[model samples]
Target: MFSKEKIILAYTVEKCKKCNLERKRKYQEGDLLFAETSKCDSCDGIAVIEKIFGETIEK
Candidate 1:
């Protein structure tokens, strides 16, 4: 019998500074995310990562 494999991913929440609207997205450590360049859905302004949640992969 083979054991089940464990797959991990991370979920992050971002907030728009202009609108205060929050959004959830998949997060990775190596990703180059800048609030200045990233746009928010509600305000079309810069979006910043507010918090990180859920299981993350260990590598």
Candidate 2:
């Protein structure tokens, strides 16, 4: 039998500046770049995608 592996991407949520609220954002494997900056929609806060890593899962 052969096993299949899948790559899982993860991210950390950031707080909004104006409201200090945290929102759940979708994280795609290639959507974000390492050490890239983003924005918070709720409060328009300055956010960044500091860390990104991949995990292998057996399927």
lDDT, candidate 1, 1-59, per-residue tens = 87666667777777788998888888767544434436887779787777766773444
Q: Local distance difference test, per candidate? A: 0.70, 0.56
Give the alpha carbon lDDT tens digit for every residue of 1-59 in model 2: 87687767565554555565654455655545433356777667766554454555666
Candidate 1, poorest ten consecutive residues by summed lDDT:
28-37
* TM-score, every prediction: 0.59, 0.41
Each prediction's RMSD over C-alphas, in Å, is 4.6, 4.2
Q: Give the C-alpha miss distance for residue 28 in model 1, angstroms.
A: 2.7
- List the candidate 1 regions with Cα displacement exceeding 4 Å: 1-8, 31-37, 55-59
* Residue pairs that clash (backbone atoms under 3 angstroms), model 2: none
